[model samples]
Target: MTLMLCSVAAAASAHAGELPRLRTEDGRHALLVDGKPYLMLGAQVHNSSNYPSVLPQVWPVMQALSANTIEIPVAWEQFEPTEGRFDYSWVDTLLAQARKNDMRVVLLWFGSWKNGDSTYTPEWVKSDTKRFPRLQKRDGRPTTTLSPLGEATLAADRKAFVALMRHLREVDREHTVIMVQVENEIGSHGVARDYSPAAERLFAQQVPEDIRRASGKQSGTWAEVFGKEADQAFAAWTYARFVQEVAVAGKAEKNLPLYTNAAVFDATGTAMAAQVASGGPNWNVLPIWKTAAPALDLIGPDLYLPLEKTYLGLLDRYARPDNALFVPETSNAIWAVRFFWAALGRGAIGWAPFGMDATSYSNYPLGARKLDPATIEAFAAPYRLFRPIARDWAAIASKHPTWGTAKNSAGEDSTSMGSWKISVTYGRNNFDIPWPGMEPPPWAKEPVGGGVVAQLGPNEFLVAGQYSRFQFMPVDPAVNGQIMSAEEGTFIDGRWQASRRWNGDQISYGFNFNEQPALLRVKLSTY
Candidate 1:
């Protein structure tokens, strides 16, 4: 069996008129760039690194990480500091530099809200509080977040977003900007919904017909329709409608697969709406967002949760048939890198870690404290290994059944492929059985191990991973299984070149993959 590579170079040379789009089939999705499947091995720079001056500190990290795409923010304040008088200088600079480095861009529009705050709005808008109203708390005191109920705010944000898209159309004809994030971590913080007089009037009004139908409530006020989740549900609808208008207008200018990022909260449904980013597209409210914002291609989660259960659970929640999984922001910490496999197994179109730049700032508890070599390598290793066959993997994942896992606190995980049970053990050495009095391995205590396996055929598999050991066993108790052949190879320019074959000592024990990048094509047979 052979795996065909989708060459990035070939994709770049496609017809310039072709725009990037998301294609979904059989509950799987692919980000098609230049009319072909594209895998975004992406890095998101620091929030303030969008200007021309700070870009000098960004490129080196992209090169080091081997990232093909950069998710950088284009602040509303900076993009249109003077409102109607727009400036596209920084965008032009970014596009020119990105092309020079052969990188695609995922522009984050930090408009109406960012992390549920209005800090990114222009001075003109911020100074005029009456025109762009802020969300009011229960005490009737205005909060920092912009009110989703404000028509003026939505109109202004939609205008700015449209202008940015129009500018992109004029400049990026080659489709260098693969996608645009409508806003960043949108929602309210202190309260579930705005308590202003205008918001109160609307809250008492009957829920819109579309929302009523989506929620299976024929007709009633927001409070009556949603019951306990009334406030959050209302808030979600308000934000979704606001963003939908902006996305619709922007798409009209140049449709390039628009999406928004959510500040993920409790996945277990224990956290109250008021405790999390209430109005955002959190997992619980995805249905509301989907029904309200049909124009948005997808809503991705900004994963800060590092636990195996939570991280993997969130992936399952977001990777649905109606919504394509695209992790726009995740922790850049060493332990978090393994979830890259989890995302891939879920058929995620793209995954990016937050705060990936040479800038001296770091979002500590959320990511690595510093950009150390170890931290950098943790993320770089997977990208380096998959860079050559990214397109191939994307295509295969979109079509085939795949499974991936990371070393959990228990240090192991397993899944089934066809008739075989594939078990992966982390921190294992070449030896399957420990000698007398053998101590545990050093990596056993370390937080680094995971891998992904894809079924190429009924009895053939493609596997790549690090710091783990893979063993396959027959599911049927009566049958025995053995590896027919295992080839160690790497894909180059869409072709697999075998460097060697594994047998005897190598096949004596299950495949032991260490820190070094290893790709294996193993054919199995039942005896």
Candidate 2:
């Protein structure tokens, strides 16, 4: 009996060590699954769609989008309704159904904070405000946001998170759960930092040495260290430390790749921290979050800004040498789908549109007003094109040079890959200039156009996009560049299967990508 137990224990340890993780090389990152690079064609369900009864509404949507990963919530209230008592029935059901559907899971832990509020906490935690204190406003009145400074609250949340991780280790030996989100949009909205007596005491004291060094400031109080941004900086430090404790404890249990999503602040440099979610992992406070939460694999942005510059700018901020870009949530509007190319171009590890389930709840102004067929197709088109080649793309992107673009505010975009300059124009016909008396395409004025181009070799490229014309030219005008061959195909089990070849009219003007799922492997040559 002793020998058998030892063997079982060794196997479990091996499995735990092989859990999903993030790998970064040459400033690009990949989510390593089953010891190989994996791309997340992900769809995040609505907040309340984790119940067994509601799960039936989710799988069909996952099938519709051709998503390989399901990002769903596991509410702390539902997981531990009674204090110190745990219930993982819903988690088990979710894992079982995901396996049946052949989908991986990214469990969003809606604990302590959900969208800048503590509403997801159990009745026990919510009712007893004294034990688990709430954040105080400037006037000393308590707000709905919990105080990260509260030791009791931290201890409770840490204990619950650890329990969840422990249970995952026991039941998830097959590694169905690829990643875990620590919390949802954690931060303080309306007010910058907790103004409670305890919070104020810490605020007046010298800033922690680690944070001071990370921020490149001399030893001083929060106000002295951060100056005008003191309040927001303090809040970020407090929240980051709180999340760090929880993540550390949880990792000790299962060692899965854990991350936290930020309710992104304004990218225009106009809105202040208090105006947005102050303590969240905003672009400005990313250094603080990184310094405080070293255990977290990454801090992902919950992108909702759909504009050209602002959206792309946030991608630049998060997809850094130190951080991997993962859009854990974005608007599911048709117009927002093009940003997927932008993210892919930046070598994002994962991207998911929020509220993707058929739960009949619409976030409206934040996302699509409805989950109609057209809305579904808008997202489904891009997923269909990449689903078969996701793993291939993930591996190539991690090791190769790639570029992605979306229709700009001016209805065109361009980038340079190696010696070739690639430009794209949306809403055009097969010809670069329309023939006399020809009408413009129906989608000419529509808000759509984007594609991703990856350099496979010195003069070879893999290209894919929709509703745009991709033209490649040699950077040096002295050399004449031409498309030697363009093969339309998809990657099957890591091999490219060419369905047809494009020539004559197709290559005459440029590679015109209509509203179809098409991928191209193009080889270029100089005349």
Query: Which digits, one per residue and each the tens of the lDDT, describe model 1 over residues 1-527?
Result: 24345354455566456999999988888888887778899999999998899988899899899899999999999989997989999999999999999899999999989988999999999999899999999899998888998999999999999999999999899889999999898888868899999899999999999888877786899889888888888899999999999999999999999999888856777356555788899887887899999999999988887777778888988989999999999999998888898888778888999899988898999999998878888899999988777777787788888888888888778888889899988876677676888776677778788888989888899888888888898888799998998999976666668889988878787888887768999899998
Q: Total clashing residue pairs per candidate?
A: 0, 0
What's model 2's overall lDDT?
Answer: 0.88
Question: Between which residue pairs do clashes occur in model 1?
Answer: none
Q: For candidate 2, lDDT tens digit of each residue in 362-462? A: 99888999999899899999999888777778888898888898888687888888889999888788776646799888888887878999888879998
Candidate 1 whole-model C-alpha lDDT, 0 to 1? 0.87
lDDT of each: 0.87, 0.88
TM-score of each: 0.96, 0.95
After superposition, the stretches of candidate 2 with alpha carbons farther than 4 Å from their true spots are 1-17
